[model samples]
Target: FFFIMNLQQITREKHTYMLQTGDLRQELKKQEGYVEEQRESLFSRLVELEQSAADYCEQIGNFHTNCLQTVSSMKQNRESATENATKYQQTVEDLEKWLSS
Candidate 1:
């Protein structure tokens, strides 16, 4: 009778352990799925950030090109203005010499 009781106790302990292990396995699976979901979300956000950075860099390059063009245009206008001023000075001096003579 004692041996039979011992066997029954062992069987009950084994059943309880199996139930607990099954629950733990289910919880582990859920945690793994959650981790995978978070990783995918992070990857998607990283891609978006990279795209935004690329666009910002492109805009900066375009702005720099435009500024260089504007500077070149201003330099040319300044040179033309200086030449015109020299010519006007020469004409004025010539007229004064003719009038004095």
Candidate 2:
């Protein structure tokens, strides 16, 4: 009789351990799914950030080009003004010489 009772007890313990193992496996599956979802979300965010950075770089490049053009225009205008002033001074000097003669 004692041997039979020992066998039954052992069977019961085995069944309990199997159930606990199944529960742990289910929990692990759930955790893995959550981790996968988080990874996908982070990947999506990273893509968006990369696109934004590209857009900003393009805008900065455009701004730099516009600034260079403006500086070139200003330099041209300054050169024109200097040429005009030199011509005006030459004209004044020629008129003075004529008057003195």
- Every candidate's lDDT: 0.99, 0.99
Model 2, total clashes: 0
Error of 1 at 30 (Å): 1.2
RMSD to the native, candidate 1? 2.1
Per-residue CA lDDT of model 2 for 37-69, tens digit only, reads 999999999999999999999999999999999
TM-score of each predicted structure versus truth: 0.78, 0.77
Candidate 2 residue pairs that clash = none
Model 1 lDDT tens row, 1-101: 99999999999999999999999999999999999999999999999999999999999999999999999999999999999999999999999999999
Give the clashing pairs for model 1: none
| Model 2 Cα shift for residue 19 (angstroms) | 2.3
Best by TM-score: 1
**How high a TM-score does candidate 2 get?**
0.77
